[model samples]
Target: MVLEAAVLYVKPGLEKAYESAFQQASAIISSMKGYRSHELQRCLEVKGKYLLLVEWESLEDHTIGFRQSVEYQDWKQLLHHFYEPFPVVEHFEKVDLT
Candidate 1:
């Protein structure tokens, strides 16, 4: 499985709004092919920060399949504006796990 991680720094008081939007946006992504699961976590110690972890079957599933689809535009519209400076997303392959 491929893991996609993003650390979003929402603009101060927009954290609640961002979380609400993410809940709505997540549904769109979940319907895509090869999308396994995802979790949106808020940082308790660091306010306005969130960790988004998404699991995919392959890199192409996200890059080519989902990103290129029309739904992605809606996804961006819903979630992109909340970021202060735009989050950096990185993909990883599972290496060692219990």
Candidate 2:
């Protein structure tokens, strides 16, 4: 599995709206190939900061498939504007657990 993580810094007072947007926009990615699941988490220390985690069967499903699809355009329209600055997305692979 591939884990995609992003740190979203929403503008102040836009947390609820952003979260709602995410809830709706999540469907776009969910419909794509190799999609597994996703989670959105709010930060306790930072009021409008959120953590977005998406699981995919492989990195190509996200980096190539999802990005090239029309659904990604809608995904950007729905949720990208809510962030103050664009979030940086990174991927990881599970190695081991203790």
Candidate 3:
């Protein structure tokens, strides 16, 4: 599995609106291929900061499969305007500890 993370800095005074938009946007992403699950976490200390985490079956399932799909455009249209400077997304894989 691959983990996708992003630190979203929403525009000031738009936190509630952003959350609402994200609720709508979530539907778009969850329906995509290889999508396992996702989360949106609000920061305790920061006023307009959120952490977004998404799980995919593979890297291509997200980077290419999701990002390249028509659904991505819907996702962007619903949630992209809420960011201040835009978030940088990164992917990770679990390390074996055994």
Candidate 4:
């Protein structure tokens, strides 16, 4: 599985609003092809900070299948404006130690 990670820096006073918007946006991503799971974590020490992690079957599943889909637009509209400088998204694979 591919793991997509992003550190979201929300606009200061809009943190609560962003969380609420994320709730609606989550449904859009969960319904997409190759979607495994996703989580949004709020930082305890930092205000207006969050970490977003999403699991996909492959990199293409997110880079192409989801990003290029019509549903992504809805996802963007709902949550994109909350970011200040925009978050950078990256993907990774599991590093087995056993």
lDDT of 3: 0.95
Runs in model 3 lying further than 4 Å from the true structure: none
Please write out the lDDT profile of model 4 over residues 1-98, one tens digit for every residue.
Answer: 99999999999999889999999899999999999999999999999999999999999999999999999999999999999889999999999999
Best by lDDT: 4
Tens-digit lDDT string for candidate 3 (1-98): 99999999999999999999999888889998999999999999999999999999999999999999999998889899989898999999999999
Clashing pairs in 3: none
Q: Once superposed on the true structure, which residue ranges of model 4 sit more than 4 Å away at CA?
A: none
Q: Model 1, range 1-98, lDDT digits (tens) per residue?
A: 99999999999898878888988998999999999999999899999989999999999999999999999999999989899889989999977877
Query: Higher TM-score: candidate 1 or 3?
Result: 3
Error of 3 at 28 (Å): 0.6
Error of 2 at 96 (Å): 3.4
- TM-score: the better of candidates 2 and 3: 3
Winner by lDDT between candidate 4 and candidate 2: 4
lDDT string, candidate 2, 6-96, tens digits: 9999999998898889889988889999999999999999899999999999999999999999999999899888988899999999989
User: What are the lDDT scores of the predictions, listed in order?
Assistant: 0.93, 0.93, 0.95, 0.96
lDDT of 4: 0.96
Lowest lDDT 10-residue stretch of candidate 1: 14-23
